[model samples]
Target: MVGAMSLRPRILSSFVGDRFLHSTPPLHQLFRYNPGSKHVTLQLSRTLSGLTNLLFNRRNLDELSNNKRKSLKPGKVSPRRPVPGHILRPPYVKSKQPPGIASGPEVHDEKGVEFMRASGRLAAQVLEYAGTLVKPGITTDEIDQAVHQMIIDNGAYPSPLGYGGFPKSVCTSVNECICHGIPDSRALEDGDIINIDVTVYLNGYHGDTSATFFCGDVDEEARQLVQVTKECLYKAILICAPGVDFKKIGKTIHDHADKYHYGVVRQFVGHGVGRAFHADPVILHFRNNDAGRMMLNQTFTIEPMLTIGSSNPLMWDDDWTVVTEDGSLSAQFEHTILITQDGAEILTQC
Candidate 1:
């Protein structure tokens, strides 16, 4: 599963600390949460000169010539769907809150690896079916319904349904949304791009995967952003192995994003996934000096977020949806992987 990286100091807890990974980006703005206040405050940092010029690729020019379109708005979310009694729910489902990331890496035994592979395959199959329903006029809620049914039919649970009170069975991030978008009643429009994040729990293990898809008649600029974002994920995955430093994943993604002048989002990152949805060591998608190493039999995820404009995010009121501050287009891709003896095996593949 993917989550926003925050540096807020907090008392250590099983669930709380894992969600608060630390990182400091050269962001033009910073977000601060005021506990007494209901919402997070968006604080401005020193502006980077020529940033506008730097982000003004073909996408920005096209938006200017055509006049910018409306930013993403929240649609009416349907009531929480119910799972069958026969399906076993994750422990966090009892609390209706996510148990924070697990303490250590998700290192598994040989038999445990097989369980992981089962869940990962189901997640990939579900995600593939979800992508097929991405045509214009189809509401994201419809997609969620189809996905929810398929997972249950396979005797698996939809991992996102109740974790931290997430309302949807799957995350449907459309257009500028960076991550954690809830599926709602809004219909997909022509030329829109979307990211579908799917995770499933089966036989006591969790599998996570996601992909960005296009609606009818998408523009070349958005298409390029989606393609490059996907390439960044694969490029990062290729460098992963038993002894590889975790920082190399960030470097691999950051360097490739730099080549196209795209912005690599720093707030959200990948994590260890297996028995629990999110675990450690925290995987950063941008360049940094985080000192962590991969080990054999370890399983985790590598997801990257890339944007055509400002990488800074503006969180919506629901506290789940994350969108680009400048309303620029963003795209992401993710997969769960296992560190094998020679290299890494992508578990979340069909």
Candidate 2:
């Protein structure tokens, strides 16, 4: 079972407006229901309270909508553009593509390995460029626009554009958001931590990578969380080798995170990335007993999401963005790696 964290519900009473109360009935008039019952009941008072609650809830909802609109300014959907004819697109982008095109991990031959390497390099480069654009006051939508252009300029296709109907080219997860954050108009503020995930398709192969970045100066606790999360990823990666048990990766990650009092996200696990954006032997980031073994030429990703509070995540209503259940800060790092003759190669290294 996935871990559950305590959540601190945000009270938005401050956002309530007087307009919601204008139609509400007065307290005396609200008490119209019968109060007498053989079973001894306060039906009238209960009815009055229910009416009052209904109005208050309506007001709260209005305030929430207004606050969301105000906080996210200049947010716009990314425009669809044409890809170069020579560029190879994932099967999902092709009309009437076969379903099995995206499946389990497959071993790559010499030429296929080279294609994977090129795609990995481009993904890493795009992520590095996106990191440079991180700063206070910039909306995530702006970052998405820049990343979209960068991927296209490099003669590649952004893998996430239409995969599973995802709207953006890159994922920009901020603060409490754990992963798959859809870029929006929310302007980043000082001390905010964000993760920029980039995946590009080149020469019929896919490369994926992501890292948590700080916006301006962050607090000591947040900084440590990001640092430890990064360490968890590397520690897991260090154990990758031909014949190594896949379970060891999660064990290492869990052990390191436990020492720091951080929570490891279990809902989402890393996976093979190459011809398909996601495939198998599923890579878990917490303790597990999976029997899969690493093999040479097998390429996969190792990404660990660590949370400052509960590791349990609650999905946003959009069905994509994942946030900590407790609304605490979370950080993640990812890299595509290839098992080699002796050890492993970090294909997505910048």
Candidate 3:
């Protein structure tokens, strides 16, 4: 019977074995029994013997020991590092101050943290108001107008307007545009996705917040990207407690994005925002775990830009607007955060 017969064996070179199309290599020769031959019966008997029995034998495989994962759970991270991002106690801007004046090493001394916190709050309030205008048929310019007036009404300047000479009151990125989306004449359409990034300087403090919203009838991919991107931001935020390292924040975010196969923007990073707007700590949100650490009372934002395709981004000629290179839709959410004694607190939460 076929089951009792010995299977033939063949040898293949490395290159031929690596080639996938040809399932089995061509055999140079074949064995056969000649009835006229003197030892034909003996040869037939030998051929009938199963090769597996001739070799080791047949056996059922147990669960693979080689397939086991190294660890069933994530490991604990070391608390201390050789180089950690400095978190100031009182919080101050990282600009040149008079030589004699000491901004506390761990925290800035001159009340700059308070100002930064205030700015972040104002930015959050502006974003919350701006989000209300995100409906179909509304021109981005009108949204810009509302944001401009809102900042002015609050008696604070819109940081994006005239920032490096930018023209809009806030950034209104749509669809493929990743960051610094310009507020312009384009009208909102059904199924359109947009990100509104707002930063305001109120009473000398900087508050920044951003959220991606749907215009009317958005697609599944865009909606999921926005939802997951927002979640990744929160995941990174939750890890922003005092004594936590900066590199780990990106590590957590990148791991989450990897699970969804979303692209992680690499060019732009979260920064220290207190007195001068963007300051000292440059927070990079990717797995390279070397950015630094968070100390008590230190403050910053962790905004992750998750993409549907390529991670590379482009900037518009206004020298302000940024977009994705592949034209795939992108989404982002940001919140100014404060590191507290026990854990990190989101200053712009809500």
Candidate 4:
């Protein structure tokens, strides 16, 4: 159970005149989602856009020159498509506005637990189906289209769609891009690595999970990084139990990543998810001052992003995509988890 001290403050603060909507980053700027009309609007800066464009083009040119071959850059944004009539869309999707953030983590009762189980299972199934499509010469937009239809066929909504203005159903982040990489028309080449993040809104709740997949034949360094990244998630999950300091999750992850000389991304942390796509008790991936405690019935996620170079990430002009500052390879894995009477239950596990 969440301590009494933890419950009241969060609930009260969350309900105090829509401040929660303004305080937290609109939607999952770090993970996924666009803000509702009620949220604060960020003004686009022309100067910033110009600088970003220059840097982006320079980076692409450098990559092409180094390889002595053409490398693909993310293409034009895909147009939004409509969900099937039978699938239930999220409030944000229906209203085209920001869905207010959840006040706190949901302490699932008997019924709530079952809903989460079903949601997690469906999300995993969708991710598995999408994984089969990863190969040389396929555009990410095509991948998104397949995933979108699959979720609709199952009578579930692709959580990322229209949530915070994300154009695609699934997130397809490629090499050098840490997370939140939007799906585009870029054709994946042989030896490239991509991370497919899938989250589905089903039965009134959301289940989020992601995994890094290799294209054709990946190099030794890339393979090891992906394997180690998965191990980091497993080791962090091992530390989850009642009364354990939440900060230890970061410590354990950092320890494992450090041993291999890999960098852990700090800009984005795993978050609580349920009725609201993202919620309270933000889970950091690096050791820090957060002292929150895990308790029974609390549901959250622990998705760690690891890079082969600098952990620092830079935001692209588009504001949603995040890439490594040093342009090194990155890999990530995510699972929605629930705190139980004895240990953590991995709801998103297939």
lDDT (C-alpha, whole model) for all candidates: 0.80, 0.71, 0.60, 0.73
lDDT of 2 by residue, 127-211 (tens): 9999999999998888988998898888899987766556788888898787888888788888888999999998889899999
Q: Write the per-residue lDDT of candidate 1 for residues 1-350, one digit (tens) a residue.
A: 12333435321111121233333242213334443322333343345424433553224645534645566899999998889999989888877456766677899999999999999999999999999999999999999999999999999999888877788899999998878888999999999999999999999999999999999999898999999999999998889888899999999998898888888776566888899887777787877777879999999999898988777666676767877766888999999999998889999999
Best by TM-score: 1
Per-residue lDDT tens digits for candidate 3, residues 1-350, read: 01112122311110011011111212112222122221111111354334412331111123212322121111121121111123221122222221111122224443766765666777877888888999988877788788877877677777655443345667788887777666766777778888998877676566778899898888787899899999998888887777888888888888888777777765466766655455546566666534357877776777888887655555444434555554567798888888877787787855
Candidate 3 deviant stretches above 4 angstroms: 1-117
Candidate that would win on lDDT: 1
Please report the TM-score between candidate 4 and the true structure.
0.81
CA error at residue 132 for candidate 2, angstroms: 0.4
- Candidate 3 achieves a global lDDT of 0.60
> Please, what are the lDDT tens digits per residue for candidate 4 over residues 1-350?
11232111121111111112322433223221222211111122668534533432123435424642233366877799788777777787855444544667667888888888889888888888888999999988999999999888888999988765667898888988877778988988888899999999998999889999999988887899999999999999988988889899999998888778777776566877887787777787876656579878888889998887655556565546767665678899999898987789999877
For candidate 2, give the lDDT. Answer: 0.71
- Work out the TM-score per prediction: 0.87, 0.76, 0.68, 0.81
Off by over 4 Å in 4: 1-72, 95-101
* Sort order, lDDT high to low: 1, 4, 2, 3
- Angstrom error at residue 159, model 4: 0.4
- Model 1 regions more than 4 Å off: 1-7, 10-68
Candidate 1 whole-model C-alpha lDDT, 0 to 1: 0.80
